[model samples]
Target: MRRLTIWSIPIDREICAGDNLGDLLGATGELADGDVVCVSQKAVSKAEGRVIQSDPEHLDEAFEAALAAETRRVLRVRGTTRIVETHHGFVCANAGIDRSNAPAHALVLLPEDPDRSARRIRDRLRFAWNLHVGVIVTDTFGRAWREGVTDVAIGVAGVRAILDLRGTADWTGATLRVTEVCIADEIAAAANLVATKAAGTPFSVVRGIDPAWLAESSARAIVRDSARDLFR
Candidate 1:
């Protein structure tokens, strides 16, 4: 009896540095209660002026500096591929410095503070429409030993990123020992299906979720601590 709807809302303008993304989003269709907005990480980064130019023929000094600046620690390196831990505790390739869809010889870094960005967007939407909703900033990431990539929530605001069903009875009357669902991440993945890179879409709205799960929380709550991390 549960239902949800995901739709991609395209912004046709070329986003630039110092652009007011809050205003840009507000200009879109009016938001409603329980609507969760998923934004592309590249869009946020572009607006934040987090782009750098690489050399034309070879990797330049800027590339190395960027890699070092964004990476907190190197986890693994095979040939030219590197898996690093970002300062935000995200484990990804090259600290999530993306070059796709950017201008020639340029790369886009992750938002400076994704959680803060989400909060700012959430607050702006509330102020504009007096609507209580959630915002999630998403990025594509490959799974360990898995082919292809899936979108995940790197930032969240005004919503609980996880649903802790531990100790809750299941359909068979069995208690769930450890069944925490990353709600925001699931929403991001669904939205990403519509906000495809080749489709020229970078944002989506997800509807029909439990608003009770909408709270003032950041995606940091979903991050696994280093102490509990089994993979390097």
Candidate 2:
């Protein structure tokens, strides 16, 4: 029988600047091999010093210039500014600059290199605990066709991002069509079931996924490049 265990563990406090992730996780318990640890991107941003301070009510010329330089397109505009998609294919209000739940006079943005962040964390955990576990940094993102939003993987290490089923034979011996599975996104969603936004649970562990599904992979496997994106 296959057994899986999902654990939602609370950190001592919200991840902030100067907090050592290895120390924090070590205080909780030993991480086992084949475990998938999902971390919220907000925490990763905080750790990476990707935070700024600005008044939400005011859109200064400098702020507008920064947004223009970073965004691909201006989705909508209100009084001060609007939501925009970054060159990296992430769409969010003010290019992922967020002021929520942050210290006063600060707006948090996504890490500069999320993949590097994942790799760093994965390496630290492995060295500290001697375990072979995968790491994923996740964030809540709004979908084009979907109403609400769901957590998705932005950074990953030691996991296969996609399960390609193209040209694979189905149960009836017919070739399957469109059978690729966004495994990272699915794992991110499953982790969200335990890591709730309002509950202050920013970390979760997903166990029991087939070990074969996890190979050293990058988020690029899951993110659709602009030229290949049909919806855009």
Candidate 3:
């Protein structure tokens, strides 16, 4: 039988710009080799200074402007909500500009380069703790036609982004096809179980992942190419 364990790391200090996230997380003294560390996207954005100040009096206008600035193109619009493609090629609502978990009168933008951010944090952890572990930057996203949101990987490092099971055999000796799984997203969602949105927990650790899945990969690899995107 296989077992997995996940838990949240409580950080007493508030995350701010110029803070060394790797250091803050490592201070928890809970990380170990073969573990996958899930970090909140807001924390990464704040640490990387990917935040914008919105006018308290003109918040609506400022949000519109900021959304326009971050968006590469609009795909769909329903009332005040927009489904758009970000410059980073992510398709998300409102350009992924999150007002929740942000400072007053401010918005937290997605990291400029999430893959690079993941890599830097992984390197920092490796240097500090001498432990090789996977890192994932997570954000809450709503699924199409779904009623609620779930945390998903916006950045990944030292972990297999997807598990391709095509051409593999399923139970009862059936051949599988088109069965690729987004393991990173699954892991991120699992981490969110412990790191709740209202809990102010910005980090979580997942253990018991398959060792073979520990490798370099990016969250961008999970993005479907525009030409093959049937939803677009």
lDDT string for model 1 (24-59, tens) is 777776567788989889888888889887677654
RMSD of each: 1.5, 2.6, 1.2
Candidate 2: worst-modelled 10 consecutive residues by lDDT = 56-65
Order by lDDT, highest first: 3, 1, 2
lDDT per residue for candidate 3 within 21-118, as digits (tens), equals: 88887878899999999999999999999888867987778888889999998999999889999988888899899886789989889999888888
Q: Candidate 2 versus the native: TM-score? A: 0.88
Clashes of each: 0, 0, 0
lDDT of 1: 0.85
Q: What tens-digit string does per-residue lDDT give for candidate 2 at 1-232?
A: 8787887878757678877665566567846789888888888888777766666555354455567776887777777647677766776667766657877756677777777788888888888877778888888887766698788988888887888999999999999999989898899989988875676777789998889977888886776776787754
Give candidate 2's root-mean-square deviation (CA, Å). 2.6
The local distance difference test score of each candidate is 0.85, 0.78, 0.90
Task: Please list all clashing residue pairs in model 3, or write none if there are none.
Answer: none
